[model samples]
Target: MLQEVAGIRIPDTQLAKDAADILREHGDNLLWNHSNRVFLFGAVNVRKTKQHYDLELLYVSALFHDLGLTKKFNSPDLRFEVDGANAARSFLQQYQIPDESIRLVWDAIALHTTPGVAEHKEPEVALLFSGVGLDVMGDGFEQFPADYREEIIKAFPRNNFKRDIIPAFYEGFKHKPETTFGNMKEDIVKHFRPNYKNKNFCDCILHSPWTE
Candidate 1:
């Protein structure tokens, strides 16, 4: 049965259930719980705001947004966010979902980690980021009704998220340091991988291979 919090429905379609199963297979308990919370929080926000969005797409986006952080989906070259996005694209393609809907999910997963920009994109994309921010950093968290917030958290306990999530982030991005350039993912490398050095932008400009 689909669960509801604050009048928003949690998707329980077979596709949604299959997606959850995939996450359970590849992700740890912390990630699985966090992903579920992201969906719930996003759904609650959308309902409270009275915005229209494809609930199934939003659920898939939230569930797949962090797949790159799992061993099964981690990429050696792409940013973890992009890795997750590509994985979503490939997965959705199997179901023959419409290209337009697939693109929205792709964008939602790809840009979920980016701040200040995602909230202005498509509604699904915006809500996905909102949920991520709420769950990960407490952004907009206090605005939600306390009882609803408690319901979401109780359904999906955080499980020492603050201490455990960093390692998962590091594991996903450590091998793709270059992909982190110009984004917050770089911060992960800078903090966790001590020897990982960021390429200086000014230095690259001065040493450009092309000189007019």
Candidate 2:
């Protein structure tokens, strides 16, 4: 079934792809598919970014990042940073992926939840963003409940949070404190949203602000 679905000729040794097949619970939650597509596009840009590596490394990293999702869900105690990287390492060792490639895979897994780690860098940062960051926010990140959906305005590095996590959770929501929530409210209501009468700079969304 997986061979028919994936339409590729891979051996039994490559459990990552098989893992992907096992993990596709919903059509929309096909994180692995999204990840694969992101890697396909991201790698094109990675090739142009002047980072030294073979194609193999990118493939290994891209495939490895999502390994812990099901494992985490089945036994919810697993932290993404701990369980995800360990799962990736186990697979990489089985595939005989080199040490350097394994490191990239580990880094990719570690920081997929926290983009700020790769924020300023190219390829590495964008690869992680394209792979999971964008999906974690959905098209607008507005589908989440009001308490958990908020803007990302934190300054980089130390103060920055995992901007995409809260906005896309199906359940197990986390709410930011007042200062954080108020800042997000300002960003959405003041900066992103506008008064209905102010037509000059406002987007079409607020054109008839109260009438929607």
lDDT of 2 by residue, 1-212 (tens): 23211121222334555545444542223444555544444443443456654444455455555555443332244443434567767766876667866676677665665535654544554465454544434422343222222211111111212342233222211121121121222232233224412223355557756886
Model 2 clash pairs are: none
lDDT of 1 at 182: 80
Worst 10 residues of 2 by lDDT: 149-158
By lDDT, the best candidate is: 1
lDDT of 1 by residue, 1-212 (tens): 34775566777888888888889899889888899889888888886678889999999999899998888888778888888899999999989899999999999999998888899999999999999999888999779778989988887888899898877788877777898888887877878767887888988899999784
The TM-score obtained by model 1 is 0.93
TM-score versus the correct structure, for each prediction: 0.93, 0.47
* Candidate 2 off by > 4 Å: 1-29, 47-50, 71-75, 120-126, 135-212
lDDT against true structure, model 1: 0.87
lDDT of 2: 0.43
Q: Per-residue error at 36 for model 2, in Å?
A: 1.6
